[model samples]
Target: MAELVRVAALTGYFPTMQGLGADPRPMLRECGLSPELLANPEQLISARATMRLLERSAEVTGCTTLGLRMSEERALANLGVASLLIAHQPTLRLALQALTEFRNRINSTLALQIETFGEEIVLREHFALSSPEPHRQSSDLALGVLARFCAAVLGDGWTPLSVCFAHERPSPSEMAVYRRLFRCTIEFDSEFNGLVIAEADLDRSAARADSALASHARELISSVMSPAMRTASQEVEQMIMLLLPSGRATIQYCAESMGSTVRTLQRMLDADGTSFSDLLNRARMQLSSQYLANPRTRITDVAGMLGYGSIGAYTRWHSQMFGISPRQWRASAARRQPQSSAF
Candidate 1:
């Protein structure tokens, strides 16, 4: 099943695109979405379609910063029912914790990983879409919205230590907009897409927190959670995405990560009509396509990124999957794509 995201994700999409001199309705229709659907913010829509809409809109309009533009007008209310819970947390850290806990309810495909290293905090955001399509626009939209959220909750004084993107840097003009919005250093072609924050920033108390409202919001959110909100297969797919680059995506490590034994994890997957190997293969197929389509990404690096032990193994797997070597596949993809832009 395709993961669903709330229509609220596109809160300012219409105006943002129109302001860029592009009509988003045509692209929305092309992606199986409509203005009526997006107007009903609580309605769930296909995550893949939403992502594809953003990418297509950007391409058609030649607006690389389309996502970031939409994010500029976003507010806490854009988070839908979970806004109250996230807004009332006592500190930035607590608010982020709320977001992590309720992420499935907010956007089933979205994943948040927060890690601390000494005085630095890293908040990595990922969308576990089952497709091989590029999600640059959606990724920018997410990070931009997140930056705005932190600013809204923590006050104008709050700024991340740095913002990072796994993709290459945009043009100088586009970078200016990014710098203006983030108000901090920006790193492109980095290991992940997320914010790097100072520990003190996250630890500081939130001036707007209301304990009673937070408790009430939590209750409301908890009441709506159901088994359908997430599944074992989805959880394992996310784990695979995270563990792949580390070369620890084996079933044993994945089961351990889920606090389950191999047999128990297998049972859960079996109940979901899948297995560990199947999920892993799907994840590899999705990621391999994305990585191979990027001309700058070396085949050896792609192999490493997909957790292959060696280039030969990756080559053999690629041949089996695509009936051609990685080099041929990359060449074919390059031929299909138009000339690269400055981004």
Candidate 2:
């Protein structure tokens, strides 16, 4: 349960493969996936496997836009029960909040956070970090699916103010497709990957919502949800992911958020066969790779994101964990990126 997404997360892969003129069966087999597996939306699969599949598909097909293609074909109903809960919420904000709250049931590894910046709301959808390389396919598919969901709830005319990606910018030809799809400005090399929605749009009533059905859906989902499937350490790690960017990923903060004292939290983690420091180390190691993958993220910023007070301290920790300076590691990753003709 490191991070699990639904096998059906690859729902669009078959069609996308057909479009790319590439046979997916071989690739699927290579990735340990198949059409039958993806047919079941509730079947849990490794998030890492999904990421690797997309990346490998892109690599093999010479189509760096593999994820975008999949996203473009994504249907809102593919979300299964979560779709029922989301479809009945009164407003887009409520629908999104419901999805975020219940996402663990669908994909325990994905993180969705909404940040309001004055009149704009940023919807951040985070997937698991699978490699040191830029996760273009992952980024595009995530944003594309988000766009589809926004359109689903806000009516066909709804569009975001901007769509952002942390990966390098696509070619002008590819950029044209993004512009057409998003119907707005697209930012590449962004610090984060997500949708930028107008604050006004979030409160707008969704056309398909049914309050009664929504309540029923909520009850159904909760009835079957095993909230404690995640260990104490896992819960704390997820909490840390949310709090780290805000400079609040401390043990005290996590304990307080969980409605427990620091000592009790420590005892609970100990009982679960992990320690608070071990959890923090694991989270930092995971997040550091993700943070460094974004070239726009400064080394100092990455340090701060990982909760280090100074660049020096972060560099020391990074060197210790990675066995190379952060700069050197990043440079190596850049050199290994696959070349595209569009480039």
Candidate 3:
């Protein structure tokens, strides 16, 4: 689950760049991005890659407000399944609540928090990532998209009382874009990145809200959220991933987590052309490679994370899977990376 995001997270990027007279392919390739990989709305891409793509594209295209420009084109349908649920929510408050719960369906690392200070309410946008280096682009993208979401749910004329960002102030040209996009008092180098508005605004009911549709959509989104209906194997793999660090990546644990019995889980996995042991081992091998590639990670620490109780046992399993000791594998991985990226 290493902070992956669905490709729909970039729902408005392609058209935005094309309209701006920029060919995004070269920028994407330089950042190790593939346009074809984004064709499938349900396909997962590295959140890090998404962040890097935005930063590099902005730098290459000389668009200081690149992220904001892209997010302005976002629509309600860009939310995927969550759109149905959010569309019918009775009020802006409830819609944001739905977003807090279902944003994971879009980006696993995105976090939205709402807090009240007196009559003024702040809806903070932050990333729950470890050391999210170069976050300004993503932050602006999130803010613009959120403003669009609020306007879609409320009305196009609805605007926040103020929009804030922790990043330094933009250039005069960029500030003009920001003011035009937000249509509200824009504060830069603020205490945090969020939207501030009167609490009364949130309480206003949506003109087109439908309680019945919202209820049904919530049920469907909640039940189908766990598995994107991809495959039983992938479902099981994700389950094992969440349980591995807790040393509970067993068949019983995976089955229970998925609300199925061990027998039923095994049967479903078999029907999907996979076995529990094979899936678990594959997940471990993949995660091990990713973890060992980080120089700051210790082999013994990786072993514990992979559910191995002893370093010797972990080394034996590593050799069985890749025909090399973890140390040697890490060395090779380091050599393959650019000198400037060894971090």
Question: Model 2: how far is 51 from its true place, Å?
Answer: 1.4
Q: List the residue pairs that clash in candidate 2.
A: none
Ranking by lDDT: 1, 2, 3
- Candidate 3 residue-wise lDDT, 25-84, digit = tens: 987787777889888988888888888888887777777788898887788888888888
Could you give candidate 2's per-residue lDDT for residues 13-67 as a string of tens digits? 8888888788988887887887777776788887877878888888898777788
In the order shown, what is each candidate's alpha-carbon RMSD? 3.2, 2.7, 8.9
Query: For model 2, what is the error of residue 129's alpha carbon versus the real structure, in angstroms, after optimal superposition?
Result: 4.6
**Ten contiguous residues minimizing lDDT sum, candidate 3:** 126-135
Top lDDT: which candidate number?
Answer: 1
Off by over 4 Å in 3: 227-343
lDDT of 1 at 312: 100
Worst lDDT 10-window in candidate 2: 126-135
Instruction: State how far residue 281 of model 1 sits from its true place (Å).
Output: 1.8
- TM-scores for the candidates: 0.83, 0.88, 0.65
Query: Which lDDT tens digits does candidate 1 get at residues 7-72?
Result: 988888888887888877789899998877777888899888998898899899887888888888
